[model samples]
Target: MDSSSPASASPPPATAETGRHAYRPKLRWQPDVEEYFAAAYGRDRFALISEALAHPSCYSCIRVNTLKSSTDAVMHKLMDIVSENGLSVGINGLDIGDQNSGSNTHEGNSMVHKCPYTGLENVIFVRGSGPHVLQYDSQPEQSVKEVIVSRKCAESVLRGAQVYVPGVLACSAHVERGDKVAVSVAVEQAVEDGGWAVDAHYEERKGLYIGQGITAMSRAGIFHVPHGIAVEMTERVYQLPSFNGTDILYAESFAS
Candidate 1:
């Protein structure tokens, strides 16, 4: 979705082109904005760009400052930390071997976590899960309270950002600080370009499911506070699987 324009209120002013090949991808972009882009850079290009933006980064890249510590040293420390964190030696172990075929351990039951790259003395690489299907209403036991954040926050959340105080547009009633809440995005379909208005109540179809988080601020604090973390996102809806270890980074230390 193009974040540069207002909510899509109407379709573009018709086009001279016709046919199925006409780049009219079902992107969440405002029709007018989509038309503008389609006008500027053909329809096909516009569709491609829209699709690319929605997907998160495929690989999690890490640049290590070798001056402070060697790559091997860091790897050993990371292995220990993950092991101590209950990854386990034989169960939830890190896949530092073949990227395509590693220990198939599901951390969240849906994700196949692993560290695919095994080289680069100064850097480490991890593979992440992708454009996988995001199950929104998977857990019914979670809190019913919800919060709607701005489109800005939605984009950031896709790139691993927590909901901040200023980004929050609305919240449910009886919400309190430190409460586990389901966080969604206030995605505007074809509303006017004036402003976004939402009541301080929960809507079943409020917005897109980004993930769940713990509220750092209460119902009042969100609108009252100017800045700070409003929700600390814990479980993401669309998670990019994390891959770290020799399996990804082919370093000398990793080889015998």
Candidate 2:
């Protein structure tokens, strides 16, 4: 017998005792606001507004930073790590290799490096270049410090950053010298919901995901000391390694 047949499809009807219903509380809106929304969007404006108000507004984008490391090198390293662990990895478009391939540059100094370990190759290097820092211009008079990472970038270090604590914010919560944390950014998106008004233009974009880091300060003493790497990155999306082992060179440079 076919299951789709009308005779075979017959099932017991739901009894009153088996039926379920949910009660929703009634909501009231101001008459003036309702009139304004009606004039602005016509029919079904309320539903549209309700949907707009509830949707997530933030989007994610990664930055390509050549100063710390080439995209190829980072991609190769990550592939090697992943492959050695017997896991498969894939990016938008790139093949995996089985051996460490020497660095190959594409388009001038910007080259792609390949690894021989996992049979994977050509993963792009992405970093959290602070949103506030504009792209560098050819002008020589520009301050190099202007291109340094932003505070928002430092916060992202909890996701992955080196053990340097000087990058922590001045007013952070109770974080110690060696605690793990997940970092996130607050982003604003424009909504057409007549539910609430937002100043889209005035909203600033200053968040970047830096990665995880180790804390360098005590939770209680952080406010008093106010200076140090509050969190050190461990694993970051952008594979910029923190040069934490250069004590001699750093001391000599400062001494001079």
Candidate 3:
């Protein structure tokens, strides 16, 4: 399947405002046009685009500012709260260890980790694993900045935005001189070919995965840089060194 496709077309016009903006349905093309989109991109792309147009565009997950806390801590705390309150949750298989431990001999574990949230950013604690942040809350008193990291970067670390050299596609044309901007992942659709699936469900897909970094180079210079972090996410939302600090405290207390 060809990975490249044209960008999404312009959305429909907004409705007349009556005090506040009134909701309006997106423009629907004729059946033939709809069929063409489905055939070209596949069903998932169609649904994702439709959803984006229908609602305020939102990414699937948000990475937390890890400088404030570590992902392990946030995840642990999130799980503890959930279990204590008796909540049922479904976690993606990738987040935990492998589902097929009996048959698969691979010693390594799955890469992803799933944590539940009571609300958007409130994380419950899990035993031994440590504390985790459930959601990112607005800190009006404290200045918080965000940036988009590609799924490529997110796969490296679950929280915060630490963009690598290769993942950056295009930065805001005007972004320059350490301007703080919210980073979002670039969304793309997977294509299918014949009976074979080009994009496997297990294979990680590209989208906004984390938020991090400052603009060290101009949009022109990004393509030129060969190494180093593109964006430095001081505050990550996933597992990081902060957990070690918590562990040290626990150890010291126990020793005493």
Candidate 4:
């Protein structure tokens, strides 16, 4: 029953045609925490982490293990490897702006995928694209056959994690393997008193949008199995596009 695997490979390069500004709800920070930070530091410092947490991550940070390999040796090896692999790799110091539009568009869609930035000998930061529109023939808002994952999983998905089997709390009936499905995050109260968890039978109210993914396991396999990825997230509205072929040592670093 362990047929499910994770989402691999960034789609083809993407454009920066982001149209995600409409009715975007802001996730506000708690008042007490904000006040505490403001008192300790200032209003400006208080908002830094809170603001970053609210938005989807636009980059994947990789701090290379300096003990394992020298930074110079790794950087040289990376340059040759990227050129041989047919992806344009630009090494920027702190200049992470105005990336050419052609490089970022993957799967024939649009988002910003910038070149790798190495600000220090051990620190390498690679950028990811989006909050891109999950372009699919969207089903009705009250559509059937939805897969509901817990809040924790939703947070990971916001940060570019695939839908693991253990995170799946419920799924609609007869959901076949490899089906393209809409994913939702269950609200806090979906779990009732006595610590009983929500199941497929519960009349779940509409939940928040994460995005769409391909079903790696059928509905039965998802519930019955204890481990593995339940869905390979394909199109996430809160996109964190992977940087593999172009980013330095990214293949070996992010290899699962």
* TM agreement with the true structure for every prediction: 0.52, 0.29, 0.33, 0.55
Off by over 4 Å in 4: 1-52, 70-119, 136-144, 187-207, 241-256
Model 1 Cα lDDT, one tens digit per residue, 6-81: 2212111111222211111134666798889899989898778887765556444455556676655655554444
Q: How far out, in Å, is residue 41 in model 4?
A: 12
* Model 4: per-residue Cα lDDT over 87-182, one tens digit each: 233334221122444433221111212233445546544344455555433443523346766656776776667887867766766678998877
Model 3 spans > 4 angstroms off = 1-149, 159-161, 192-209, 242-256
lDDT of 3 at 215: 62
lDDT of 4: 0.52
The model with the greater TM-score, 1 or 4, is 4
Model 1 misplacement above 4 A: 1-49, 74-121, 130-143, 188-207, 240-256
Report every candidate's CA lDDT: 0.51, 0.32, 0.37, 0.52
- Least lDDT summed over 10 consecutive residues: which range in candidate 4? 6-15
Model 3 poorest ten-residue lDDT run:
247-256
